[model samples]
Target: MPTPSAPSAPVADGGLFCELYWGTSLAEAWSYGPELGQVHAAPDETAPLPLYGFTLPEEPFLLAERTPRGWRIHVPPSARVEKSLKGDAFHPVGPEELTGAPGRAAVELREGMTLRLVEGELRLLVQPSVVKERAGRFRVRDVAWLITVAILFLSAPVAFLTMGPDPARLAANNARALQVAHDKEEARRKAMGLDQPLKPLTEAERATQKQDGGARVNVPASFGVR
Candidate 1:
């Protein structure tokens, strides 16, 4: 078994690989091809597996090799395999239980199938790189959303200018508002007795009031005199 080391970059050959999921969350992923031959988990102090949280066996217990037909995983006594055929429910089985071989305990992994290791504390989702690559490519819906965003961005200024109030009308509105405010202030001053308006008497009323020989002869009707 090969000692666990830092995972290398993915190859462009679009080969099948296993995705390592720690419970419900994906932890790490490893790719395998004919060039690398096989992959395994063996303890190495210099460069340990990048996985965190859980510890793997100090010795090589889990091994995956590229077979002629597909990738085959060998299950040791310390670990048990749980295979999911429909991706929703899983069925637990011994390594030899699937192969029906008493001595050898190995099974080939298929695409879209999930495998769970009881002792390993992780699940493996089998898929090909081509599928992942295709999924990463932009779809029609993504392009349409981008177009909609661009249209909104480019049309923002136009919409604001079109829907905005006219400058001439705004100025007229401001003038009217100032006039109304002045009228209100004047009314408020009068209500508070801070401002008073003088009333001029008519000529006849002013003529009615006179003084004779230092005594008043007639008074204006406004003075409450008959």
Candidate 2:
């Protein structure tokens, strides 16, 4: 007869190594890595295993608590953080989005470690990084939009020059101006009673109303009407 054995614990390979610092002095240093089948923290390797918390990497991808200094995780500049649960997709994790909590805020490191901030004592589990694709500066849609805007900006002056001013509109404006001038002149003539055709002066009328050729005026006529 064969004897059944107990299930063996799961193995943990890597986790975030957090070192809390105050000013230039190191306050605390802990490594959150997998030990056996559960997540645990160690001051070193021989330290006692304390069960802290659990994280569902399949779900929201994060399990964290608030700290006094807020959620401040230092990421290496050379490494980029990406996230994908189903393993086929991944996107670059932005700095703002990395401040995650109440949701998945865990980031995958390039060196095969998963990093997350936690409150209280440190506890960690191993989750491998999965990012097969990388993004560049400009996408196809972005480049197309930029090109369209540039074309519009550059062609504005050329379009304006080519179109010029409307000839029909200018002619209509000139005609309206001429009509306005004619109407003004006609109104003035009507007001002065000179709008009608003039009649030629008769000889008697002209003789009676004729002015002297010299500068001298008739004294009686100049002084009083007669």
Candidate 3:
């Protein structure tokens, strides 16, 4: 996932050239890899501007250009911290479904990972790094989703197969037998308790219990085993 080498050397009226590609989805094009933050920056005379509070990766993230200070990323106070944690299945910040942004925009996910957006769509700069890493190591991304779906898909048959055995079948039959046995035991318990006086129940507990036939069994005092 090599970036197309620095478009040019550092300039004063510092021009961070970028080629970004935003789409209805971040991954629709190229730039926005699956991470925290990617911010585009330009020189401002007055204020030390603030950025959104998306956190950065703990490890050294891929940066398009290296600074003389080495690959250093900054987190700003004004940066808006996300409502929830990252990798939450979808973006909490977005509902717009915007594809890309074009400018000297400094885009970042909740990580120190920074990309210098050269002139173009930010999508271009966002290489498929995470996808690449996952793909490179174990082809996890390629198969992960399928593996998950497969597990879910195979669940039905696997469950059937597990129960397809003699032991499981026997166990299941025994479970049914036991259930009947338990029901008979429960009935006997009710019969035993019926001879006793009623017990107190909390108001809420009694209210709920009343819905399901109170006290497990509500035989009248006069009723006998006969």
Instruction: Point to the candidate with the largest lDDT.
Output: 1
Q: Could you list the CA RMSD of all candidates, in the order they appear? A: 12.7, 18.0, 25.6
Ranking by lDDT: 1, 2, 3
| lDDT at residue 117 of model 2 (Cα atoms) | 35
lDDT of 1: 0.61
Q: List the residue pairs that clash in candidate 2.
A: 10-37
Q: Which scores greater on TM-score, model 1 or model 3?
A: 1
Candidate 3 residue-wise lDDT, 28-82, digit = tens: 2222222223333332222122111222232232333333322222322123212
Regions of model 2 farther than 4 Å from truth: 1-135, 209-226
lDDT of 1 by residue, 75-139 (tens): 55455678886457888854354663443467766655556655556665554344223235788
* Two-way TM-score contest, 1 vs 2, winner: 1
Q: Model 2, residue 122: what's the lDDT?
A: 35
- Error of model 3, residue 133, in angstroms: 13
Tens digit of lDDT per residue, candidate 2, span 51-166? 22323233222222223321223332223444434343455556665644534343323333334333334323223322222335798999999999999999999999889999
**What's the count of clashing pairs in each model shown?**
0, 1, 51
Give the residue spans of candidate 1 off by over 4 A: 1-70, 87-105, 110-113, 120-133, 136-148, 158-163, 177-226
How does model 3 score by TM-score? 0.16
